[model samples]
Target: MDTATASKNPDTRSATDRGLPWAEIDTVLFDMDGTLLDLHFDNRYWRELIPDEYARLHAHEPELARQRLFAEMERIRGQLRWYCLDHWVRFTGLDLLALKVRLERHIALHPHALDVLDTLRVQGKRLVLVTNAHPEVYAFKHARTGLGNHLHRVVSAHALDCAKEEGCFWERLQTVERYDPQRSLLVDDNLAALASARAAGVEHLRGVRYPDSRGPAMQSVDFHLLESLAELLPDRRLHAYASSPV
Candidate 1:
């Protein structure tokens, strides 16, 4: 069934009122930090720890350091550089990679993310982890969480030199991944990335309701909402393949 038809079906409701045409989807693209993994680590590192570290390193007042860092973060908010650890190190004069390594304990997968991934894999769906994380950051997180075992491939925006917020990122991704937009589903925590994907002609899109485990749930206006990836699991009793523990 097409998405339009599935949307109109009253019986389609499950995790959300706007049910997806799961049967028609072949490729499932997932965002890394927020969608499949807990976003609290990233949020805490950037919002709290970075400011504190910057203050300590530069001998600036904590509040002042936060203000300065926040301004720089805002300046590159949706750009690829915002997600690049090397760019951040160069811009802030902070050893971000080292700091991330120090805080690797915070990196973790969201509940049931593995179950959903395993189910999709068992069902013969092409799974790709698409993230705006820098190559260095991706490596750090992947090493800590070992999420790579569950995915067919992982694509970082660093490789494309474009953030997922830009439609050109999707265009460039298509050249490399060669996914049929209509038959693919993208689950992301960022609305901007979803908008870009939609504009790039991707037919199926879903947004995470609660990206950060420590934060309140967000309402998604433009795409279907999911409380968790577990909602997409084919069977609640299905056991995921064993992998390196997070």
Candidate 2:
């Protein structure tokens, strides 16, 4: 695919035109939630359901429970523990994994995400799923979405004892799963993770413009912004696909 012309909109086209060496990319790293899958599930689970469950368990008002939980979440916002269900279980004295299993219905792939995955598979790209999600959380989502079947490997940042935001995480990741940073592309929803990967020398980087399907689109990004995964499809195929009915 010629990324420059495959962009879904003018803003994305402008970003793609900025000399991205897409032809040289061999390894494609993907972030799980938001990048490939819809992020609404995670947002609602953490912001709404968790607070409601906490209130039910603690005999507190929903608003009070939300305040307390939000405070704790904020304290560890960017830390590894923030993505760990085991850490949450210990912190909240609640079975988080079980709760997640019950809420599995909310899990879903982003629009045209499967189409993009299929295209990458056909193109023989080395696909890798990288996420900050804890092993239990990753397992649940992987099982629910079957995203693992499409990838060469699934990596949890917890395995490296660091969040993707940390430079050390990339170093640790390289040692475990070797890939040339210069020939690789990483598509992630988190700007911090993309920045970390860039610092680690990953050549091609793309960010999802709307990580949360129900939320407003992001303003401007330093790297290529993908409005839809369909934007990565081959130009001729994309044109035909777009013209087809839903």
Candidate 3:
């Protein structure tokens, strides 16, 4: 798909706009961490809290112990095992929910995230959040962040028994949600997860890079490289007339 094409609205064409191949994407599935919210929360929680909690449990130097556990956690961040907060807490024996709440207290949504979600909802699109986070962790995050109000559904990989890296997870999500893959767009920061959805026949995919990052995204499944969800608003009207295959 030559995603860099001329948009229907000539006034609003971006330099990268060959335009997305699929005509109109209705169902937008968003990945939470790096896509909608900043990823520093997860990184800090595991790298800092897990070890401090462990040290408190064992009477060791909390700072030094945090470094040790952070090193261990860093080695497995991308693996499927790390996707589940419960599994991590079980192995490390930390109260994951308590730790998550700590992170959630400072957590905030990405700039324009709420605007984009609201625009899609106003346009009558079904907004489903497909995240790899455990139910409790995201639940706490949502309560604090107010992201729950913007989404139609929030489906976690834990409930599906498949992380995005696993083949059957996307299939299970489609089966349960009855979402049309072709007419849907899945946005995530994880390249592997985006590719997994692409392999499952999802046509439109976008990768979101964080606002503070100077580097490009580390993934290839992105049809659109979005700096923020707010970018969708101005040009969405162009796609309003373009009929997407349902």
Instruction: Highest lDDT: give the candidate number.
Output: 1
Give the backbone clash total of model 1: 0
Q: What's each prediction's TM-score?
A: 0.87, 0.88, 0.77
Q: Candidate 2: where are CA atoms >4 Å away? A: 1-12, 15-20, 60-64, 234-239, 242-246
Top TM-score prediction, candidate number: 2
Cα error, candidate 2, residue 211 (Å): 1.1
TM-score of candidate 1 relative to the true fold: 0.87
- Give one digit per residue, the lDDT tens place, for model 3 in 1-246: 111221322343356654454347768889998788767676666556666778787675766666666676778766656777666677667777867677665476765677678877887888899988888878888888889899999998888888986678889997668888899888888877878888998878777655223233443434556644545653666343232211
Tell me the tens digit of each residue's lDDT in model 1 across 60-84: 4767877888899999899888888
Q: Please, what's the RMSD in Å of model 1? A: 6.2
Residues 154-246, candidate 2: write the lDDT tens digits. Answer: 989999999998899889998778999999989998888999999999888889888887877765548777766676664444544433332
Clashing pairs in 2: none
User: For candidate 3, what is the total of clashing residue pairs?
Assistant: 7
Q: What is the C-alpha RMSD of each candidate to the true structure, in Å?
A: 6.2, 3.6, 6.8
- Cα lDDT listed for each candidate: 0.80, 0.79, 0.70
Ranking by lDDT: 1, 2, 3
